[model samples]
Target: MKNNRLYAQFSTGYRAPQTTELFRLQAGQTIAELDAENINSIELGLRGQVESLFYDVTLFSMHKDNFIFQDTNRQNISNGETSHRGIELAINYQWQYFYVAANGTFAKHRYDTNLTLSRINIQDNEIDTAPEHIGSVQLGLRSDLGEFVELEWVHQGNCYINPENSSEYSGHNLLNLRTGIRLSERLDIGIRVSNLTDEDYAERDDFGFGSYRYFVGEPRTVYATVQYQY
Candidate 1:
């Protein structure tokens, strides 16, 4: 047997348009009822070491759909769902006083609005933060000086940002760095720096004729951490 509940909410200052599919001054009201039961997740992968290097790889896929959204202005109530199919890779290597690790993700996301939504190809962006390409790499070493540390890095560029490729937004290559020392095998400390060059970027772009000014992610940040694991 299955049971379900339904609810509707209007914001303190939100009102939906009267009888509309989309494209109104006021967002539309949504009536939603769902049925769910017995859901679970599973992963499959392999791990092994070759010579002096270690490798782990995973291929996985998941899908979701059946959702709805209504804007306060009622002109942008759009609903859609998409899926992600991709692989995760990891590799580690060690050489006298030097260590390196690398990882990456290759995935594809596709979304279609339930009501043929459109605005610079936003109907396709509904998948939410699903980048077509993603990757990262890291390197570290205990310098011969025992104090001077050099960091190196590289990663794949994000391929998708906001449904369409050319919609006032572009993908970017992110960089990171970190270095520190080990007070002891039981306790170690380090710092990580991101966006080394301080590039101006946005994960989401707003284009509504200056109704409001939006903010994106951070420009740069440095953090230090000390930890002990049993």
Candidate 2:
């Protein structure tokens, strides 16, 4: 308990209907009828340091009333209720010339009450495109000469692609590499390679109108940057 801390929090949130949701007319309608969204949340957390290692963890739950969303017809509507719950973790460690850090979230986003959308019943169903797992880890090394390099791995877990929960998108993983050096007292140089493995995956996926659609992720790419302080 010497280097540890525990905390708890409760919060509330509110969001008024957006102009598009209020002003956009649906077929044969002058204006869409929508209500503002309100949410209540609770969270518990712990953080501490053990020697050279530091870590933090949290658990959270949130509930919302009148959750606003667009139906398959692209018309704005409000769901009666929705719930979100999750756990998150972060850790870091360092020793001499090397260091590592990682963070992640595991969560569920669900409709809490039975509702009809686009002629479909969605009750206690996971929200479409809401991945349950997402996280990244990074390892790096540095020297007293102001040079450093890092390698990172990113991950996304699978999720439903449609409100029906019948279609899913198998998630993806990617690797990235970056290095930088202080070129001079006023300058710095850096290079980065994203999607290092050139993996093929979709940045986004959707199922609609009897079809599955995808927005492809970027291929491996390299970037260079030089910064000068004025």
Candidate 3:
């Protein structure tokens, strides 16, 4: 492993179906029985610092059974099964007063079985909110005088909006700027301006009530903060 660290891990997880999801009777539909979902996962990772650069990489896979999800018909269902596999990477470097940091993830989350929904068998479809790619990069200036300024770019790849894979939320990218200064050993101040480009986007999207709707993402905004450490 030299100057790096390598590790492997296995874990199990469980989640009970939400009470509201299970008992919220809609119209004339009867409440259906639901079961807790379970997952088994394995992960392998390597982390280390090489000179001024620091990096960590990880690969992971998970198998989930009786996965609970909301259906297109607005009913909660425990589908057959699903699998998720992914890789994540992070790196940071500093050269004098200038530095950069970046991280990214690429993954696939898909059905591992033919799930019967509304008299249809759907298999190998991507899940909602599970984009195939997501990443962020930040470049900054820092000094011994306790001052720093940074700009960051964030990105998300296109993702399906429902289990039927009928629609997509065509991804988005955002820019943000931040700066801070230390007034004293125990006092500091900072300002952040997010969505620097004022791009229009949506945090979530879905088809409901025979129409498409979205929760609009936040627009360009600014704020300041002050901190006093005891």
Candidate 4:
């Protein structure tokens, strides 16, 4: 699914705790009022498939009067943001013995931030880790070993940080294996492994960026399970 140049406008109001003393957020804080207004937004989408296995995509967008950064402690700063235009895609195939799939994301998200402070005003540009392009694929094969077994590979494209767009982040290629057996009537057992290759990669940047950056990913591991039903 996709969207384009859609705008959202809204207003909200709130009341602070009634206090005998002036509303004190910090030792020396200064905020205007408890009401907000004129917040705006927009979006766009482009996607399609080919031969029922291949795919294509694109995304364009812009927004104004948005404020996710106003959560700062300044108490007197209001900011708005927007996103850069981009695209993404994927492909896949499946057979009795072998199956594969691939996909990617391409987008440049940015925002304008401003703070209202006396002699300490601030404004800046922030580039998104969405990256102008993102891509990855997966391949899997099935086999017999007294039971049905399978192993698969997965990979992703790189990401980024900072408005200047530097230090292109690295992606991780992961592999997994699984096997199962019929233990008895309505009973089954299975074994599996994650991150089979144990490839070292950072799913996110040290600082907040893109979706869930700054979060460390997991390493390789193994597990076993059994299930019974009547």
lDDT of 4 by residue, 134-164 (tens): 5556666655434566676666556555434
Q: Write the per-residue lDDT of candidate 1 for residues 50-98, one digit (tens) a residue.
A: 6678887776665444434433343333244545567778888988888
Give the candidates in order of lDDT, highest first. 2, 3, 1, 4
Q: What is the C-alpha RMSD of each candidate to the true structure, in Å?
A: 11.2, 1.6, 2.2, 7.6
Error of 4 at 25 (Å): 5.1
* 1-230 per-residue lDDT for model 3 (tens digits): 57799989999999998888688855655875678899999999999999999999999999999877655566677866999999999999999999999999999998887775424556888876689999999999998987999999999889987667888999999999999999999999999999999999988787657667888989999999999999
Candidate scoring better on TM-score of 1 and 2: 2
Residue-by-residue lDDT tens digits, candidate 2, 198-221 = 999999998766788999999999
In order, candidate lDDTs are 0.54, 0.91, 0.87, 0.53
Error in Å for residue 210 of model 2: 4.9
Query: Candidate 3 at residue 83, lDDT?
Result: 93
Name the weakest run of 10 consecutive residues (lDDT summed) in model 1. Answer: 1-10
Ranked by TM-score, top first: 2, 3, 1, 4
Which residues of candidate 2, in runs, are more than 4 Å off? 72-74
Q: What total of clashing residue pairs does each candidate reach? A: 7, 0, 0, 6
Task: Candidate 1: give the clashing pairs.
Answer: 24-75, 26-73, 26-74, 27-72, 27-73, 27-74, 28-74
Off by over 4 Å in 3: 27-31, 70-75, 116-119, 183-187, 228-230
